[model samples]
Target: MTTESIAGATVSTQANVYFDGKCVSHSLTLADGTKKSVGVVLPSTLTFNTGAAEVMECVAGGCEYKLAGSDAWQTSGPGDKFSIPANSSFDIRVDQAYHYICHFA
Candidate 1:
Protein backbone atom coordinates (compact mmCIF):
# COMPACT_ATOMS: atom_id res chain seq x y z
CA MET A 1 0.00 0.00 0.00
CA THR A 2 1.04 3.59 -0.57
CA THR A 3 0.33 6.79 1.36
CA GLU A 4 0.18 10.23 -0.19
CA SER A 5 -0.33 13.69 1.19
CA ILE A 6 -3.63 15.30 0.31
CA ALA A 7 -3.02 18.76 -1.08
CA GLY A 8 -5.40 21.62 -1.61
CA ALA A 9 -5.74 24.71 0.50
CA THR A 10 -2.71 25.97 2.42
CA VAL A 11 -4.00 27.41 5.64
CA SER A 12 -1.01 26.09 7.59
CA THR A 13 2.64 26.85 6.95
CA GLN A 14 4.08 23.36 7.67
CA ALA A 15 3.26 19.75 8.29
CA ASN A 16 4.78 16.64 9.79
CA VAL A 17 4.10 13.21 8.31
CA TYR A 18 5.17 9.59 8.62
CA PHE A 19 4.20 6.28 6.96
CA ASP A 20 4.57 2.58 7.67
CA GLY A 21 2.97 -0.41 5.89
CA LYS A 22 3.44 -3.40 3.60
CA CYS A 23 2.35 -3.70 -0.02
CA VAL A 24 2.53 -5.71 -3.23
CA SER A 25 2.81 -4.68 -6.85
CA HIS A 26 -0.26 -4.52 -9.01
CA SER A 27 -0.68 -7.17 -11.61
CA LEU A 28 -0.81 -6.58 -15.40
CA THR A 29 1.32 -4.15 -17.36
CA LEU A 30 1.36 -0.53 -16.29
CA ALA A 31 0.01 0.43 -19.69
CA ASP A 32 -3.14 -1.68 -19.15
CA GLY A 33 -3.49 -1.79 -15.36
CA THR A 34 -6.41 0.17 -13.94
CA LYS A 35 -5.36 0.23 -10.28
CA LYS A 36 -3.54 -1.69 -7.61
CA SER A 37 -4.56 -3.26 -4.32
CA VAL A 38 -3.11 -1.73 -1.20
CA GLY A 39 -3.84 -1.30 2.49
CA VAL A 40 -2.66 0.79 5.46
CA VAL A 41 -2.09 0.17 9.13
CA LEU A 42 -1.82 3.00 11.69
CA PRO A 43 -0.60 1.46 14.91
CA SER A 44 0.21 4.11 17.46
CA THR A 45 -1.08 6.13 20.38
CA LEU A 46 -3.14 8.92 18.86
CA THR A 47 -4.37 11.87 20.87
CA PHE A 48 -7.15 14.04 19.54
CA ASN A 49 -8.07 17.44 20.87
CA THR A 50 -11.47 18.68 22.03
CA GLY A 51 -12.80 18.84 18.49
CA ALA A 52 -11.01 16.05 16.73
CA ALA A 53 -11.95 12.56 15.61
CA GLU A 54 -10.81 9.79 13.29
CA VAL A 55 -12.29 6.76 11.53
CA MET A 56 -10.22 3.62 11.31
CA GLU A 57 -10.78 0.06 10.14
CA CYS A 58 -9.16 -2.89 11.80
CA VAL A 59 -7.41 -5.19 9.33
CA ALA A 60 -5.58 -7.43 11.75
CA GLY A 61 -4.35 -8.22 15.26
CA GLY A 62 -5.73 -7.05 18.60
CA CYS A 63 -5.87 -3.46 19.88
CA GLU A 64 -7.09 -2.00 23.14
CA TYR A 65 -9.21 1.10 22.53
CA LYS A 66 -10.77 3.59 24.91
CA LEU A 67 -12.76 6.78 24.60
CA ALA A 68 -11.92 10.06 26.32
CA GLY A 69 -14.25 9.42 29.27
CA SER A 70 -16.10 6.62 31.03
CA ASP A 71 -14.42 3.45 32.23
CA ALA A 72 -14.97 0.96 29.44
CA TRP A 73 -13.31 0.19 26.10
CA GLN A 74 -13.63 -2.32 23.28
CA THR A 75 -11.13 -4.50 21.50
CA SER A 76 -10.64 -4.18 17.77
CA GLY A 77 -9.45 -7.56 16.69
CA PRO A 78 -9.59 -8.70 13.09
CA GLY A 79 -12.99 -7.60 11.78
CA ASP A 80 -14.01 -5.81 14.98
CA LYS A 81 -13.89 -2.05 14.44
CA PHE A 82 -15.14 1.39 15.48
CA SER A 83 -15.36 4.95 14.26
CA ILE A 84 -14.58 8.20 16.09
CA PRO A 85 -16.69 10.94 14.66
CA ALA A 86 -15.89 14.63 14.76
CA ASN A 87 -15.59 16.35 18.16
CA SER A 88 -14.42 13.27 20.02
CA SER A 89 -11.13 11.77 21.20
CA PHE A 90 -9.66 8.39 21.98
CA ASP A 91 -6.49 7.12 23.64
CA ILE A 92 -4.78 3.96 22.43
CA ARG A 93 -1.75 2.14 23.80
CA VAL A 94 1.56 1.72 21.99
CA ASP A 95 1.14 -2.02 21.86
CA GLN A 96 -2.18 -1.45 20.10
CA ALA A 97 -0.39 0.03 17.18
CA TYR A 98 1.27 -3.23 16.36
CA HIS A 99 -0.51 -5.96 14.37
CA TYR A 100 -2.59 -3.50 12.33
CA ILE A 101 -2.71 -4.21 8.60
CA CYS A 102 -4.85 -2.73 5.86
CA HIS A 103 -5.33 -3.85 2.29
CA PHE A 104 -6.88 -2.68 -0.93
CA ALA A 105 -10.56 -3.60 -1.03
Candidate 2:
Protein backbone atom coordinates (compact mmCIF):
# COMPACT_ATOMS: atom_id res chain seq x y z
CA MET A 1 0.00 0.00 0.00
CA THR A 2 1.11 3.55 -0.69
CA THR A 3 2.24 5.49 2.38
CA GLU A 4 2.19 9.14 3.43
CA SER A 5 3.47 10.98 6.45
CA ILE A 6 1.54 13.28 8.79
CA ALA A 7 2.51 14.74 12.11
CA GLY A 8 5.81 12.86 11.87
CA ALA A 9 4.09 9.50 11.41
CA THR A 10 4.14 7.39 8.27
CA VAL A 11 0.78 5.90 7.33
CA SER A 12 -1.02 4.14 4.52
CA THR A 13 -2.90 6.09 1.85
CA GLN A 14 -6.12 4.12 1.75
CA ALA A 15 -9.05 6.09 3.13
CA ASN A 16 -12.78 6.82 2.87
CA VAL A 17 -14.13 10.06 1.49
CA TYR A 18 -17.41 11.36 2.82
CA PHE A 19 -20.07 14.12 2.63
CA ASP A 20 -20.25 14.34 -1.15
CA GLY A 21 -16.57 15.31 -1.28
CA LYS A 22 -16.84 17.99 1.39
CA CYS A 23 -14.40 15.90 3.41
CA VAL A 24 -11.54 13.64 2.39
CA SER A 25 -9.37 11.67 4.74
CA HIS A 26 -6.72 8.97 4.88
CA SER A 27 -6.75 6.19 7.42
CA LEU A 28 -3.54 5.58 9.31
CA THR A 29 -2.12 3.22 11.87
CA LEU A 30 0.38 4.43 14.38
CA ALA A 31 3.53 2.55 15.44
CA ASP A 32 1.42 1.24 18.29
CA GLY A 33 -1.34 0.33 15.80
CA THR A 34 -3.68 3.06 16.96
CA LYS A 35 -6.00 4.21 14.19
CA LYS A 36 -6.38 7.82 13.13
CA SER A 37 -7.24 10.01 10.16
CA VAL A 38 -5.83 13.11 8.57
CA GLY A 39 -8.31 15.11 6.52
CA VAL A 40 -9.38 18.33 4.91
CA VAL A 41 -12.79 19.85 5.37
CA LEU A 42 -14.11 22.23 2.80
CA PRO A 43 -16.12 25.30 3.75
CA SER A 44 -19.35 24.02 5.20
CA THR A 45 -21.30 23.38 8.34
CA LEU A 46 -21.34 19.76 9.37
CA THR A 47 -22.40 17.69 12.32
CA PHE A 48 -20.58 14.51 13.25
CA ASN A 49 -21.02 11.73 15.74
CA THR A 50 -18.15 9.88 17.32
CA GLY A 51 -17.93 6.32 18.49
CA ALA A 52 -14.61 6.90 20.21
CA ALA A 53 -12.89 9.83 21.84
CA GLU A 54 -11.19 12.02 19.26
CA VAL A 55 -8.53 14.69 19.36
CA MET A 56 -8.78 16.99 16.37
CA GLU A 57 -5.73 19.07 15.67
CA CYS A 58 -6.00 21.91 13.24
CA VAL A 59 -3.24 21.68 10.70
CA ALA A 60 -4.26 24.65 8.55
CA GLY A 61 -7.07 27.19 8.43
CA GLY A 62 -9.74 27.27 11.13
CA CYS A 63 -13.27 26.29 12.15
CA GLU A 64 -15.80 26.87 14.90
CA TYR A 65 -17.27 23.99 16.81
CA LYS A 66 -20.13 23.49 19.27
CA LEU A 67 -19.72 20.42 21.36
CA ALA A 68 -22.53 18.19 22.51
CA GLY A 69 -24.51 19.57 25.41
CA SER A 70 -22.89 22.94 24.88
CA ASP A 71 -24.39 25.97 23.19
CA ALA A 72 -21.18 27.95 23.10
CA TRP A 73 -19.09 27.57 19.99
CA GLN A 74 -15.32 27.65 20.09
CA THR A 75 -12.93 28.60 17.33
CA SER A 76 -9.82 26.64 16.49
CA GLY A 77 -7.15 27.48 13.99
CA PRO A 78 -3.81 26.23 12.81
CA GLY A 79 -1.81 24.57 15.60
CA ASP A 80 -4.94 24.42 17.76
CA LYS A 81 -6.73 21.31 18.94
CA PHE A 82 -10.05 20.19 20.39
CA SER A 83 -11.30 17.01 21.97
CA ILE A 84 -14.61 15.17 21.60
CA PRO A 85 -15.80 12.46 23.94
CA ALA A 86 -16.89 9.03 22.80
CA ASN A 87 -20.53 8.51 21.90
CA SER A 88 -20.87 12.22 21.44
CA SER A 89 -21.60 14.61 18.62
CA PHE A 90 -20.41 18.05 17.59
CA ASP A 91 -21.17 20.73 15.07
CA ILE A 92 -18.43 22.36 13.03
CA ARG A 93 -18.66 25.38 10.79
CA VAL A 94 -15.94 26.35 8.39
CA ASP A 95 -15.73 29.39 6.22
CA GLN A 96 -12.61 28.13 4.44
CA ALA A 97 -10.93 24.84 3.92
CA TYR A 98 -9.65 23.38 7.16
CA HIS A 99 -7.02 20.70 7.54
CA TYR A 100 -6.83 18.50 10.60
CA ILE A 101 -5.50 15.33 12.14
CA CYS A 102 -8.04 13.26 14.08
CA HIS A 103 -6.67 10.82 16.60
CA PHE A 104 -9.08 8.17 17.82
CA ALA A 105 -8.67 6.43 21.11
Candidate 3:
Protein backbone atom coordinates (compact mmCIF):
# COMPACT_ATOMS: atom_id res chain seq x y z
CA MET A 1 0.00 0.00 0.00
CA THR A 2 1.06 3.56 -0.61
CA THR A 3 1.67 5.96 2.25
CA GLU A 4 -0.90 8.70 2.10
CA SER A 5 0.10 10.85 5.01
CA ILE A 6 2.66 11.29 7.75
CA ALA A 7 1.78 12.57 11.19
CA GLY A 8 4.00 14.23 13.79
CA ALA A 9 6.79 14.97 11.34
CA THR A 10 9.02 17.97 11.57
CA VAL A 11 9.01 19.49 8.10
CA SER A 12 11.49 21.96 6.69
CA THR A 13 9.67 24.76 4.95
CA GLN A 14 12.38 25.43 2.42
CA ALA A 15 12.38 23.22 -0.60
CA ASN A 16 15.42 21.45 -1.94
CA VAL A 17 15.49 22.14 -5.63
CA TYR A 18 17.71 20.21 -7.96
CA PHE A 19 18.59 20.02 -11.64
CA ASP A 20 17.55 23.61 -12.10
CA GLY A 21 14.06 22.97 -10.71
CA LYS A 22 13.49 19.71 -12.45
CA CYS A 23 13.14 18.16 -9.03
CA VAL A 24 12.12 19.64 -5.69
CA SER A 25 11.60 18.23 -2.21
CA HIS A 26 10.96 19.14 1.38
CA SER A 27 12.92 17.45 4.12
CA LEU A 28 11.08 15.72 6.93
CA THR A 29 12.04 14.27 10.27
CA LEU A 30 9.74 11.90 12.09
CA ALA A 31 9.31 11.89 15.83
CA ASP A 32 11.66 8.93 16.12
CA GLY A 33 14.23 10.87 14.05
CA THR A 34 13.64 9.00 10.84
CA LYS A 35 14.60 11.04 7.83
CA LYS A 36 12.44 11.34 4.75
CA SER A 37 11.72 13.64 1.85
CA VAL A 38 8.59 14.31 -0.09
CA GLY A 39 9.30 15.38 -3.63
CA VAL A 40 8.22 15.64 -7.24
CA VAL A 41 10.25 15.31 -10.37
CA LEU A 42 9.18 17.14 -13.44
CA PRO A 43 9.50 15.85 -16.96
CA SER A 44 13.24 15.35 -17.30
CA THR A 45 16.10 12.95 -17.06
CA LEU A 46 18.35 13.23 -14.04
CA THR A 47 21.02 11.47 -12.07
CA PHE A 48 21.11 11.30 -8.28
CA ASN A 49 23.74 10.05 -5.89
CA THR A 50 22.77 8.49 -2.59
CA GLY A 51 24.49 9.16 0.69
CA ALA A 52 22.40 6.56 2.47
CA ALA A 53 20.28 3.63 1.39
CA GLU A 54 16.98 4.85 0.04
CA VAL A 55 13.58 3.43 -0.68
CA MET A 56 11.87 5.48 -3.36
CA GLU A 57 8.15 5.19 -2.82
CA CYS A 58 5.96 6.46 -5.55
CA VAL A 59 2.89 8.36 -4.47
CA ALA A 60 1.66 9.48 -7.92
CA GLY A 61 2.55 9.33 -11.59
CA GLY A 62 5.60 7.30 -12.59
CA CYS A 63 9.25 7.18 -13.62
CA GLU A 64 11.75 4.88 -15.25
CA TYR A 65 15.09 4.36 -13.56
CA LYS A 66 18.43 2.80 -14.37
CA LEU A 67 20.81 2.06 -11.55
CA ALA A 68 24.50 2.68 -11.90
CA GLY A 69 26.44 -0.30 -13.27
CA SER A 70 23.20 -1.70 -14.70
CA ASP A 71 21.83 -1.49 -18.19
CA ALA A 72 18.27 -2.45 -17.33
CA TRP A 73 15.74 0.28 -16.85
CA GLN A 74 12.90 -0.30 -14.41
CA THR A 75 9.53 1.29 -14.11
CA SER A 76 7.94 2.51 -10.88
CA GLY A 77 4.40 3.76 -10.57
CA PRO A 78 2.00 4.80 -7.89
CA GLY A 79 2.23 2.61 -4.81
CA ASP A 80 5.40 1.04 -6.13
CA LYS A 81 8.88 1.38 -4.70
CA PHE A 82 12.52 0.76 -5.62
CA SER A 83 15.64 0.58 -3.56
CA ILE A 84 19.01 2.25 -4.04
CA PRO A 85 22.03 1.25 -2.00
CA ALA A 86 24.08 3.74 -0.08
CA ASN A 87 26.92 5.34 -2.07
CA SER A 88 25.17 4.29 -5.25
CA SER A 89 23.50 6.30 -7.96
CA PHE A 90 20.57 6.06 -10.34
CA ASP A 91 19.31 7.73 -13.47
CA ILE A 92 15.64 8.61 -13.69
CA ARG A 93 13.57 9.66 -16.64
CA VAL A 94 10.16 11.18 -16.21
CA ASP A 95 7.68 12.00 -18.93
CA GLN A 96 5.27 13.51 -16.46
CA ALA A 97 5.42 14.76 -12.91
CA TYR A 98 6.48 11.96 -10.62
CA HIS A 99 5.64 12.29 -6.95
CA TYR A 100 7.51 10.25 -4.37
CA ILE A 101 8.73 9.86 -0.85
CA CYS A 102 12.42 9.18 -0.28
CA HIS A 103 12.77 6.96 2.77
CA PHE A 104 16.22 6.69 4.25
CA ALA A 105 17.33 3.42 5.69
**lDDT for position 83 in model 2:** 97
Assess each prediction's global lDDT (C-alpha) against the native: 0.43, 0.85, 0.96
Residue pairs whose backbone atoms clash in candidate 3: none
- Candidate 2 lDDT over residue span 24-53, tens digit each: 898877677788898988989999899999
Q: Given candidate 2, what's the lDDT at residue 100?
A: 88
For lDDT, candidate 2 versus 3, the one ahead is 3
Ranking by lDDT: 3, 2, 1
Per-residue CA lDDT of model 3 for 25-81, tens digit only, reads 999999999999999999999999999999999999999999999999999999999
Give me the displacement of residue 36 in model 1, in angstroms. Answer: 16
Estimate TM-scores for all models.
Answer: 0.44, 0.87, 0.97
| Overall local distance difference test of candidate 2 | 0.85
Clash numbers, per candidate: 5, 0, 0
